[model samples]
Target: MIANKSLSRLMAHVTPGRLLSLGFVLVALTGAQAQETAAPPPLAGGSQDEIKQFCTNIADAARDQRYLLQKQDLDKLQTEVNDRITVLEKRKTEYEDWLKKRNDFMKQAEAGLVDIYKTMKADSAAPQLQETNPILAAAIIMKLPAKQSGLIMAEMDPKKAGVIAAIMASAADPLTSKDPS
Candidate 1:
């Protein structure tokens, strides 16, 4: 056949070195083509589709677990807030009790102070009361009999007596007189 004759002619002209080089070139080309056409190895987990399906299956459960964790954190925060509120309430109760006891003691001390002032001479009591807190002096004077209060006021410095009188007036009518200052 004409093709066989041409192949024979081509083989006859090709040298041994040329044939060896041609074989190498062919092998190189074939290896490159094979590499291009071959599929990459599958991942350790599985094929892409299987991995995608696995992730899809776990998505809802993962989301639920995340939400549960968030809820637990919120619950813990709420409990801490509640505990702080309870402690605040306890402190408030203690403060109120302490204030009430302090007020009761002040009232008893004020009564004893008034009794001492009542027995003293007006001149002696006036100087002592003036040296005391003006508010305390005023309270003592108010508790004294009207005649004794007048005697004490008559003996006090006019400016101090006037300040005490204003305090007494304000105390008497708290709604109308808010502050002596």
Candidate 2:
């Protein structure tokens, strides 16, 4: 109240225009100070940019993690597939090697029988054939000419001769045997 009375006394001495201008200037300064101190209004939406940015960051992290997980799964699957293929390939190679050895053994056995039949006389070979494996003896007799094989078969025991004759007959065909009729 005292300050207002002092301002009124000072204004009374001043011209009307100057006093009005001073009052306007004071009002403008007070408004400027109020604006400077006042806080800005809050947004209508949730929290604002900070929360949105945090959500975006979280989403990005989730996406990156998902991609990494997929890559890890794919890598594991690929390794398993490669391992299976390698195992199958190795097994195939071993099987092929076994087949080659079996074929080599069969060829050598056949060649040995052929040599034995060719070197020995029918009487000697027939006695030996009767002593050895029936299947092996039949195979040797089959390598000889029909006449020679007949002589050897005649010398063998009847049951053994029948077995050899049966094997020889089964082995013969139009493609492999000469006309005996």
Per lDDT, the best of the predicted structures is 1
Give a tens-digit lDDT track for model 1, residues 115-168.
Answer: 888899998999998888999999999999999999999999999999999989
Report the number of the highest-TM-score candidate. Answer: 1
What candidate 2 gets wrong by more than 4 Å, as runs, is: 1-89, 173-181
Q: After superposition, how far is residue 87 of candidate 2 from its true place, in Å?
A: 4.3
Please provide TM-scores, in order, for all candidate models, with all chains considered together: 0.59, 0.43
Report the Cα lDDT for candidate 2.
Answer: 0.84
* Global lDDT scores for all candidate models: 0.92, 0.84
Residue 160 of model 2: what lDDT? 84
Model 1 ranges with Cα > 4 A deviation: 1-66, 174-181
Give the distance in Å from residue 146's predicted Cα in candidate 1 to where it truly belongs.
Answer: 2.2
lDDT of 2 by residue, 18-74 (tens): 879989999999999999779676675666877898999999999999999999999
